[model samples]
Target chain A: MASFLRKNRPLLVTLLIVAAVLLWMTNRYEPKVTASILLSGLTLGALYFLVASGLSLIFGLMDVLNFAHGTLFMIGAYIGFTAYANPRLILNTLPFALALLGGAQAGRWLGGLLPARFKQRWQDSSFLVLTFLLALALLFIGVRGFNLEKLVAATATATGGVVATDLAQEAAGRFLPRIILLAVSGLFLGLGLSRVGTAEVRQRPRWTSAGVGLILVAAAFALIPIRTPGEVFLLSVSSNVRFVLALVIGLLAGAGLGALIESSLIRPLYGRVYYQLLLTLGLSYVGGELVKSVWGTVGFYMDIPAFFGGSGDNCPSPNLWSWFSDHCQSINVLGRPFPSYRLFIIALGLAMFIAIALLLQRTRLGIIIRAGVQDSEMVQALGINVRRVFTLVFAIGCGLAAVGGVAAAPFLGVNLGLGLEVQLQGFIAVVIGGMGNYVGSAVGALLVGLARAFGDQLVLSGIHLPWMDGVVRMSPSIARASTVLIMALVLLLRPAGLFGKKD
Target chain B: MTNILEVNAIHTFIGQFHILEGVSLTVPQGSITALLGRNGAGKTTTLRSIMGLNPPREGTILYAGEPIQGKTAYQIATRGIGYVPEYRAIFRALTVEENLRIAERSKGDLAKRGDLIFELFPDLKRFYRLPGGQLSGGQQQMLAIARALVPENQLLLVDEPSEGLAPIIIEAIVAALRQLAAHATVLLVEQNFRMASQLADRYYIVDDGQTVSSGQMADLVKDRPLIAKYLGAGYAGAGLVPAQSTTA
Candidate 1:
């Protein structure tokens, strides 16, 4: 691991900081509570994996950066829900399956329907414009007629003149819209990943699928709207920062997502970096607007899952909002009670992560995927239609991302900017993981996750340092500043991402 | 005679360099015609154009007497013509068996014509387990010839079979070409005058994408200048008629 770190200097620096911060955060001694916090992290990471995987597969196979991958993912969700109108059906497994299949078929059809000039137009820089069109189309169609529910009619009508709405932030994030959005997202994730067998994508990444399944189970519970009881777990003796843990975990999660997105999508698009960046920006705008269209833009409200809900309390679980509701901790050196529940969620997240690792390494499918990833031609010569494999891999990747979204939505509250917000973090994770390396990607995800958590806490503890943007002169924000700064530094110090071997 | 393969003044351009400039050739019914040329000659380009892997910028390629210039490689391959590239372009990752399977003309192999290939190249039977990448130089040459034997026992475009092979293997290949000519029309591209003179029934010596020399095998073997200028050697001891071998 140390040698691995040395080879991946940028990843190393990130890992050390992240690990140190996680250790520091946990030092508060919320023993029983750490599990749930980790679980929360894992859930969030899973969703990132879904999107990152698709982007990764596309980039690896086609040598094209899908700047609008997130938008496509989001579109899958919309199409799925369009097929199945029941909000409750999105919650049920059978309905979700049907919708997911429908959505994936739509994606495949759309994929095939892409201009016959795909070889020429899709290969050039102008491809970004196409992505922008796709994103814009999805947002316009998805958001405008979401409540209209006439499925084909709304999507096909094209010119359902924009509803004159003066609604802003506080007015949007409501009950019905949030539920609909959640179902749409789940269906999208499932559909995106449905290509495992059909697409022959990267030889069926097993770990990602298993991890996705586990995450789905967790999300199903989260989406249950059912009440569950909880108990106070073991306490610690440290009088340290409880809120500090919350802020740290939040910021770190954000940073990791940012990193993963950058490397998987943004990094490889450097040749057409302008197009990718522009596409990301355009898609992000669409995503934000879509969110605004759903709820009214105030604050999202969803019933907490039984796992997070308090014991027999009418109101859902009550713990610090910082980390996921894992357990309460004994440490409080900084004046706030350490969040035991959120810490537990993080622990769950870690366990979920281990599942992902085991799935990637120990499976036959994984072996085939590894071979295909290295040299697809070698695998294709074996009579496997590699194109189908690519499609499956992309779908699986997208599924993992959707799982992450559903799992994280409870804590972060799914918003329009949520995909883009975490998009950069995912890119950061890719850099941390090392470019295109599976183990590297996981390691990178962890390091960036912990780093962001630490950086956020560090900033709050009387650190008045102004951070730089990714480039020397670029502007920066507290939330985005550290991630971009770290990425820029990593890129400069080592061209290959920290954990990545030189290709 | 019904010409099995015909190239009518075909021209080809790779990027900017004009290579196949109005070159034409014909393989008479069931005859082994040698496409002889020096290095940097357009023999390879002509084969490529005829196979439709590289389309002629201006001209027509008639196969079994049909215009097949603009067809895809697979389309051409499907239409009873098998091309063995100069580089021995075997699917390297595939085992020798798999490579054969891919090339095994699904439609044509059913007829006992394929048995003739195994009889000709029994060495392929011995090293059948090995991957195409692991084959020795001689074995690969045999495999390249065997690969063309598929598709259809109709028209085989064997490019430079005696190229860089040992004399022993060349002799074996010569014997196989002798057998092959009985069933299929053979278009053999060769630099080795001795091998071409022994196997080919007719000669079309191409240089710089133009047919520089053309005649019967008897005529080509007797003309010492033809041998010296085009083939780099002369028929000394053996009479041109006796050396004809009647092999191809």
Candidate 2:
């Protein structure tokens, strides 16, 4: 039993803390409010987890302290927000894409109809020629016939799309072309992808497929029906598609930015701690300033998609799916209405945690990474490219931070100060969890999130004690301060952190 | 025999301290060459310089007649030179199997090497799933040697294999080295002159970061005063122990 305790002390301590927090919450608040707060806390924790996981991973593998992690997060949020705000781009790009699709189909048809005596190269050449002709036709259509303003005006006039009642019809009319265009682009995209696939096997140039994809994207962009009020902000687009697209783009953007930073800035100064710290701190400021210059000083409200937002008489969220619409309203857990979005966020966090765990534990690359974390020189001597693994780990760490930023955008809104604030919390979480420990970072993040929620929400005004007059106050400052307090307490108790191995 | 490795007048520095000054050495192909020296004699530095870990400021390291001085450690390793450092730098957190797996350049060679390693040190196979940190000192030394061999390396640079081991463990290690020398060229550095003369065909004595002596091990055995002059009187006594025991 003592041996067991020694082996799993971190796990047991964490469970105990969680249980204590839960008990305290249950005793103080009503079941419904407690549930709501718990969900919110979990959701918040998940966001912190996303950010902290990357920080821990990079710190563990590379031994580089990344202060600029938050900047990547902000960048991801901005990218996702920008993508989500632009439904018009998707809608506009649709009509011009028809020819590209038709061209690929035509190429396939020609390939099938060609004489059996023709050589494989000749058939392939014919296919290429047909695709090129169709692309040319698309270019013509884009340059001459495609006028997004005229198309929008025409749709508005013909469909009587003025009031909110006809808005759905107008949207339907706008989306129909988008759907068709998507299908067309998708078809050509598939053809291009297949070419790439064949090139991999045959050692052929995959440029033709790439060219097809570029043309398709260009055609799609040419058809975008510009909207004045709608395309300017994230709140303008309430569609689930826009939200999903934004999230994916945000993750990729974050990952890309991470790769860029690692290759350009961090690569040369791998083992130098002071230089890395100075460079990363300077980068954070530069990145924050760059964001401010581009997006301006004003904060943009992160609009929760209709499917994920509150649905009431004041602003009844109009979801295409009735199942989502049904669940969009607050879920009653005693008498209080608990936001389901928080629950969804919590679920996302759990999924991400499991995914990262599986990635680190299951894959051969992960095993190599883990070994590298322990003794990098040995791994290198073993003939593994430890430098490449370092880059990959750093990028992944930064990408996860970006995921946190984008995920938290709806709750916190997009602002210039967002990065620094989240980064400070992430650092605190790292300290609380233990430096260079992944699981500790996650546990620390959840604790911070829970403490913040409970600190702000749990009030002692109603309860009356027989022994003495009792009152406890809660404030927003207290909520923020709670993270610092928890970190201090954890440090006092376990200097190496709960899970940190003694160096 | 053709020389597999040639270190030509290499100068190495570690943070303002000149560790190796004009250190030159050669290891012939498919032969065990021993580097003999006292503590802090730059023997380890010489091996590290050859591996490109502390790439010499001035000099060239030619492995298989290709210039490898400017190459990275992994590049040097991938080119068929394996290194077992003095400390036995094993990934202590990883399992014995994982340590071997990470060292392997090609997965296809694992089973063949695994068989050879198990045959050499059966204790490694018994604790295959155990973390390297949990292993005894001798086992760690064995694991370190086994790791270097996993990549099917042509040359092996072993530093202080018998540094701190019991007579029985050292006996096993000496036997393993004899078996391994049949397949790959070995550059061994040893404080134990007894083990060194037993395993090595040739000897290069390094003193003050320079190669002080280089000759056949047979000649090194004959010249006790020469060994005493370079490796200290204790090492000379240890080196000629087998011969004295045979006479007895």
Candidate 3:
């Protein structure tokens, strides 16, 4: 018994602490309030886990501390919001996408036409510069060509002067020819870029990739009918389907952006930690500003899907078990009404955790990742291309963060500050749990979430200590600082974090 | 025999420190050529250079008659060369099975060599499910060598496999390498001159990042003065001659 206690001291201590907290909470507040607070804490923890898992995995494999990870989250929320509310905004921008693609392809073709001597001397830089110039010219022409006043007037006339969020759909049907042009340009661009990316590795890019891209573009065009009287707007689709579409679009956008950043920015700066930190930090700020410009400065709440029932304060059932049969904005949990979406967030977090764990444990790719974390050079010597793996891992990490953003959009509301806010908490959780340990990050996130929730409660209703006569009151700022305090305390006791190994 | 690997006047550097100034050597096909050198004599660096880990800046490495100096480590490894780094360098957190699985160049490579690996190092089979860190030092060295063999590499670079093992373990390793040499070429780095003389058919002595001498192992065993000069006086006095007949 003594040996067992000594061996499982940490686990025992954690259980003891949890019991003490629960006992203290039940004494101070009603069970319903306590249950609600704990559920909320779990919801927050789910969001943090979604962000931190990817952060931890990326850091473990690449030794890169990505400051722009939060930016990916912000982008996810914006993309999801756009997909949910105004997908036509994206479809309308295809011409601009085509212009950029055309410019890039033109630059590549020009580079290919260059003499071998000149090409060898300049390498791909000249092509990149030419691409940049051509893209700038295209952007200038596109801006000059787009008459916004005429578009707004046309939209107003089409919508009978009652312009709504779905205004862009009115113009979508006219861009069919442009869509075909974009698809063709995208095919050539995809082929050329794949060649550039895999030339060093000597991998031949299969036609299936281009075929898939074309099919997807064609499918998107088919799915959303071309300005038919009844089926013109994507918003006409069910809200739940749109929400699912948002999730998919957000994930793809985040992954694509991640791959681009890794191949272009992070690849050249490997082994230069400070430079990478600087670059990513600068990118986060740029990303935040870009989001503000695109989505506007003010935050907005996304409407709950119809599957969860219409948004209102009406409660038909008071029993927690009734949630399974009834669809309501809020569900009764232990006599307290809690947002059912928060429960969904909690479920998503747990699901993501299990999925990530399975991916890391059961797959062949997982073995390579675990081995790469220990010694990448040795992994490379074993015949695996670590660079491609790095890019793939980075993309996966960003995709996970984006998923978190989409999940958080309904509960927390979409905003520019959301990314950085969750990112800070995610970093704290990672530090507290132990850098590069995903399970530890999850636990750390839960701890932080619980601390924040309880701290907020304490500030609202001052805690009464057994030793003290009166209720001990403190400033509300203490609640905000509670996570840092817990982090500091954990660091003081276990410097490498709860799960981190000492170097 | 035709050379499988030839290093010509390679100059290697690790973060601006010139480690291998003018190291050069050639390994004949199907032979276990031992690289004999003292500590910090760039013997390990020479192996790393051929593996394209720390690629040499001023030399050409011809592998199977093709230059591979500018290639990445993975690219060179895919060309059928395997490396067993000094001190094992096994992924400690991973299981023994996982370590071998990650080293496989093609799918089912491990399954193809499972019998051969277990036949050579039966202890690895016993510890297949256990983490590499849980294994003993000698077991880790076995796992590391076993990892290199999973890909059916044409050439194997074994660096200081006997560095931290007992005499019994070293004997087992030497026997395994003797068997391995019949199927693949090997470039072995060893401080144990006796082990080198026993397993190797030819030997090269590296001192101060340069190959000072090259000859048959029998000739090297006879040259006590050369051993005393390049290796320390301690090695020469420690009965550096082979205890048994050298492997062909």
Candidate 4:
């Protein structure tokens, strides 16, 4: 059948088109179902992109599997939180930027701090021992300083800023350097955009700067004092208060730092190693250790202040969550009102998705990245600074992850392991999408996400099987199983990935 | 008249097995010099050590009077020295254009020099768009040499340049070597004696990891009968080599 379909290309195409349309019609949506599916998929897919990208590059370029990449994603988020909350640290936009930069620099310096002979001999596998040893040492230290009593919480930002979606309270004269938040967001965008092989960038962004710029601003706002319209700025920060600017700054800083790391440490370090895949394991462990050092494993999500922050969950949120539970004004369209929360989240995700798509498709950086994905050695040979492009690609990937982290924080629990599970999925998505193809990854993510959602959701309540694993009772989503299935299918059918040219 | 490169009494070891023991050779400016040796006699290993792809345990490899015994291949390349390794290390996954690009880092533009290389091997020009891997052995060898060329190349270390080339291709290579000698210096390690004899200005022979013969290419020509005695070929009757040359 496979050979027949392959030979009869036009017949195959017609059958595929018919099947797609039929499937689409069968899965028609009401707002709530659509939105819930969309939200989970976006957050999940974004997380995968974040973790898998690093893993892929580590393996694809260097050939390192990095069994520990999940740990690194967790670590980066923790670092973002710690940098935001800690005192006597670099404050404000610029300072926050520096802290993130420092973290990444530290990762690189530590990652590369290996003996010459060992590095030459072990190559990528070399990092496994060197980094694992360093991580184990740090782990020993961590156990001494902060004992592991795991506190499980969703969306726990490091500074203890709990997710509260009350628009009225948020605007009720709590924090006003709205420009700073905008600046931080702008900086996040900039950090994401500034990557040499940027997918797409705003030509004249209102708030576009490096992580350092955002950090300095966050610090200045926190420490320097800002007297804006009906807003009180305090020097002594509260134990359970929200540093809105800090989170924003942290995102920007983390993004930039991630970029620098991609270039200075990753490219050169892996260049020496023989099997690039093992780089992931080293990077993951290093990331885990770094996170453990900063946050000490007790996740915190507290309130910043009532005026600049929301007093309660009832207060309503301007962020997507609020737009969902409170803000989305229900309207009668065709005499039926759709579930508002699902619609808003879905829309927000769609907008971001479209924007990302355009960024990858319609920009010069995107073109180079897409091309470089297939042929990096050639790109360098063409007088393009391939090293710089690699760094930028990494930064952009990190920045996207950060954005997804913040946006999805309200929906899922934001803890160390948030990016971990999805990281592997990202690899699967990229692989299923055909390793380096951007459009293919997106489609693959959605397909995988939807499949998982369906697998988890679809159930015959009336019929009960007495003997089944706990997962069946706990909603067995294909999310966990889908990756392996997809990978196996790809291996058997399209080993090169969906969009990949056969090597 | 000036020695571009000089290796003096170099000794190399690969895990205790001594290779290139007491080996010495010199490369003169704007001229071809051949380092001839049997398999496992450490000709390729010497080139690798010179490029810092391998470090020698004992010896001095001096390039332009600067002792460059320990430098990375990239660093060695940037220092006006291009090594066309014996294996033809053309980045297999990369296209011909990309292969040229990675090797394109001289003061002058690499594009202009590429033109001259293609002119020497017009077959490469005809299939310039193809991937380096797709090219035939001779084409890859040509691309490999073309990859090493620069407008003001201080020195070129070519390993087994004519090893597998056809007679016609070998002629083209010899002609190109002569042309390159009009400008850049060359250190050739050749297996084809005829090819080396036509192009080399000086010859150094290594037997069992030790230098056995050293003289001008012109001098070796007059002592043609000695090839059978020393190298086990060419010389007709007497076992001893004769010292005779038009220059002398």
Best by lDDT: 3
Candidate 1 C-alpha error for residue A210, in Å: 40
The DockQ of each candidate is 0.05, 0.27, 0.68, 0.06
Q: Flag clash pairs in model 2.
A: A54-A397, A92-A223, A92-A224, A93-A220
- Which number leads on TM-score? 3
- Model 2: lDDT equals 0.74
> On DockQ, who's better, 1 or 2?
2
Model 1's DockQ score: 0.05
Decoy 1 TM-score against native:
0.49
lDDT tens per residue, model 4, B184-238: 8888887766667767888888877788898887777667555654555632222
The fraction of reference interface contacts (C-alpha pairs within 8 A across chains A and B) present in each candidate is: 0.00, 0.59, 0.90, 0.02
Give me the iRMSD of candidate 3, please: 2.2
Pick the winner on lDDT between candidates 2 and 3: 3
Please estimate how well model 4 matches the true structure, expressed as its whole-model Cα lDDT.
0.54
Ranking by DockQ: 3, 2, 4, 1
Candidate 3 stretches with Cα past 4 Å from truth are A1-12, A94-116, A124-131, A142-233, A310-321, A467-469, B239-248
Candidate 4 local lDDT, A119-215, one digit each (tens): 4454435444444355444334323422122221212332333222122122213333333333333332323222212111111122223333545
Candidate 2 lDDT over residue span A259-316, tens digit each: 7678557877777899999999999999989777656677676677767665666332
lDDT of 1 at A186: 40
- Ranked candidates, highest TM-score first: 3, 2, 4, 1
Interface RMSD of each: 8.6, 6.3, 2.2, 9.4
lDDT of each: 0.54, 0.74, 0.79, 0.54
Quote each prediction's TM-score. 0.49, 0.78, 0.90, 0.61
